[model samples]
Target: MNNINKNQLFWASCLALLVTSLSFGIRAGILGKLGTDFQLTTAELGTITATAFWGFPLAVVIGGFIVDVIGMKKLLVMAFLFHLLGIVLTIFAQGYWTLFISTLLIGIANGTVEAACNPLVATIYSDNKTTKLNHFHLWFPGGIFLGTLIVILFNSLGLSWQIQVAVMIIPTLVYGYLFSKLEFPVTERVASGVSTSTMYKSVTSPLFIFMFICMFGTAITELFTGQWIDVLLKNVTDNAILILTLTTGVMVIGRGLAKPVVHRFSPQGVLLISAILSALGLYLLSTLTGNSIFFAAFIFGLGVCYFWPTMLGFVAENIPKSGALGLNLMGGAGMFAVSVYTIFMGGFYDKLILQKLPEGANEVDYLNATPGSEMADALNLAKNAAGPEILQATLIVPIILTIGFLGLVIYMRSKKTNLIISK
Candidate 1:
């Protein structure tokens, strides 16, 4: 295979990353505004966010099929259209359902973007699939960092959050323009002339199952961390923007540096370490108070930084022929799993902490509480009212990490065994 023109691929992927990161950044930046505007509870907000995911699985599936037929340019154009429409809808959105519908449309667009670009990156560098794919994915968090900075500037200038959401249209239009002119690579499955039935058959293998399992744990680890960090910090302290900046900042650095570390350790090894650290970070943050909690969040961000993209890269390296279909299935499955996981977290947090708080427990006092004797009373009060739900939420990261680590070991070993048997 010809070596990919790294410069062109890099720019294209950056544009894709910018759009992806901007979508998430805008959602997170305007979360507070949505809460105030719609009077949404954490649970309600989870529902609204999760609503966007409802379209994701279907879109990825459809996009996979369509991209193989019509090409990435058409699908990307459709994605941009959906994104533009979603932004417009969000600006005029009045209630929970309106927000839900708007997000659903937007999600369809997001899913298509992932379905098209993931395989595009892999095909562009068939020989250096993992390395190039990791580089491609570095932009996810990189974009988040850029978007966070933009949001901060916009907010500082006294712009309305609605205007902030609308401004995302600029990136969408620009990327759409770039994509419109680019000739996309053919779907790997299509080039191989692999029948749909045979493709489905391929995924029934042990490797596919193992990758899918890892994908689940990784998705839960990633989405839960990214989507909830802002809310989690808000619950702890009033400095939402600062805390978010710290969290995303850590993520950006982690992903930016991941290329080398991932090259050294391999994606599976990075994933294993990430799972452990994420669990440790979540447990530490969930139980601690004051600046320590903030510190723990940064740690968690570091742990989670490599997860989603690494998993995508792993699949690209191992299952290259599955093409956009494989990308869609994995992305769809992961997002759908995260949607369910986030809702569970929302309920778990509500039952254990939000609902059970003492009638007059000041959020500020709770945030400022020292870790020693003083925090005991507050922690006890929270525990008593919240039951075991806080513990449940705390276990989320560790449990997922343990599962992913074990799955990775099993997957790698299985691959080795299969190779030996084939020999």
Candidate 2:
């Protein structure tokens, strides 16, 4: 049995994730500011946000292969440095290129944290992989709650956005200190002496392939909605920030309760139910308005709360031989999906605005219009017209995911029966 301090490592991991989540929240809050200050079009802003996921897959994939070789401590040190550097770059960003590069660095750091810590936690708590992973992932939404609260607080105080970004430095430093001098156990795959060739083969197997494809849809459902929530709800509701906070707040509670849910429903069953809820939630968000928006967001939050961690948990439990690389690839795939979808959604919004605008109106003039001005009013009108269509388009992803998970549930049930008979 491993003798290291699991609690310290777990909390340290949570702090690291907290930093990532804070970064995400702060970035979401600043998107409007970025567009205003930089005079960026909606599509340009989308490209910038997409940059946040661009480097993630590369870092996680590379980190997964070498994590066991360099150890978690070293990977974490790299994460700290990248995060620090990325924040500095973001604070000083002057234009699209600078913001893109800065966000990409942060993406790499976020991916490294996921790559190192998921397996670290799985290794430390091997017996309850799914439940523990759910507990570990609680920090994600928890941090979002804190970060959104900070934004709401800071905005009320009239502080600069830089101050909001700077607040993340505190948690980053704390996590760095916690990780320092701590020993990390080898990955379960390495400990079991599973050769790398076998690991490679496991990822290529048909089941893994199916899950990988489903991950794309699941990620699009959760992340595309999340990253664009503020923008999507800007004109629809006055409480966009609170709505964002409330959404993540619901996620925090749901993830905290995941242990019992997993005990009752099996991971596959839980995923199936989550998929159905997610699809329904998205459809509601696309079609409904007024007081019902909160209800839709609540359902969406409950649906996605378990997605990222649960997907990782399923792989950890079902495909133990695939090791850290498997977890890394799963994370990488999700972020990659988000990256593509962000840009696509941005373009979609841009196209819709053009369609809604009156003949001979200038797109650039509307895009760069100051808030409360006539041009800005026209732009908001176009956004209101187009927003529902964009959201409806996003619903396709979750609907597909619902069907896929239903099939997986049936397959797993049959597999379990055969194993019971063999026993």
Candidate 3:
């Protein structure tokens, strides 16, 4: 540990992760603007958003395989360069393809940060990996809180979305400077003398494979819905982005108190309760409206608050042999699932809207119908029903999560003391 500045490296990572999360929050805020400005349909916008998730898994999975050989510093430098390129490309985006490419680059940068930092935090605080991991991950939501507030402020000030995006460059540059002078530690796998081949093989274990699949449910439940919240809940409430700000606000606090919660419930216990609350929250959002929406978002924030970090912690503590590969693959799997789910969720929204329209009636037909006429009434149904209907479809993800976490908690209990404690 000589010459290594743990505090500097750690906060640099928080700031880097901050940049990644800020991108998510800002993109969520501007999704509607991008769609309207580019004359895009919802499906086209979804494909552009999905491009970001697609690039994420590609970069993080590849980084996982190579980080040991190339070092964290090189991967972080890659993230720095990608962040700048993505921002520049997005600010100048002329159409669909340009937006897609720019968002993809940003996703790659986001994934690279996770690839380098998750294991970095785990390596530095070896005695308390899970608790510290949660502390580090608190910044993900903390950044979103800041980003969403920035977006709300920008919108109020009448700033362009481009300027809102460019704000990320400040933190990106700050983290970039901090990292340039800091020394990095070896990954947990390397420090513990685990062989590369063994690390590769460990992720194939029955437990790891189970978590990988479960990750699909947990991640899509949180991310796909989050990225689409502006579009999905817009019909139900005039200020839907406020729900996002509210949910992430709850998440910031929830993650900050992770230690006591983990102590009281154990990691498996935490997953079980999180799954239940998340399911309830989604159900309420699908069913409720008006001021009640904030209540649902708060429930969701509490439910998902501990999910990402705890999932990684469970693997790190119970399956230590899997090491860095396990952690990276776990995070990568979630993003990959969301990549595909976003397209499907978008299609679901488009399909619902189409279904609400009379056969052979396009959106133009609806627009052309005379107000107060029976024909206009037919399309008004689509406008009023589409958002809630798509949210109803999302119920399936969290429903599955509830069952899966239940089984995990029960299994850990039956095993009775070996892996249940999480540390």
lDDT per prediction? 0.71, 0.88, 0.87
Model 1 ranges off by over 4 Å:
1-6, 193-195, 357-394, 410-423
Candidate 1, residues 1-423: lDDT per residue as tens digits?
243354665576568667767767667767766865676666788777776666777788788767788876677788888888987898889899999888888888888777777777766666776666666776776666666677778888998877877777887888888777666667667766878777776667676777776677777766656655556655455555555567667877776676688778877888788888878776765666667777877877787777777777777677665667777788788888878877776667555553456676554454345556565456546644352244345566557667767777777878889999999
Q: Compute the lDDT of residue 239 as modeled in candidate 2.
A: 56
lDDT of 3 by residue, 1-423 (tens): 898888889999999999999999999999989976876777888889898898888888888888888889889999999998998899999999999999999999999999999888888888877788899998988887788888899999999999999999999999888888889988888888999778878899888999999888888888887888888887677778888899989988998899999989999899889998998998888888889989999998998898899999999888887877788898899999998989887777777878888888786555557778887687557756898777788888878888888899888887777556655
The parts of candidate 3 lying over 4 Å away from their true place are 364-381, 417-423
Task: Rank the models by lDDT, top first.
Answer: 2, 3, 1
* Whole-model lDDT, model 1: 0.71
Task: Choose the strongest candidate by lDDT.
Answer: 2
Residue range with the least summed lDDT across 10 consecutive positions in model 3: 361-370
| Higher-TM-score candidate of 1 and 2 | 2
TM-score of each: 0.85, 0.98, 0.94
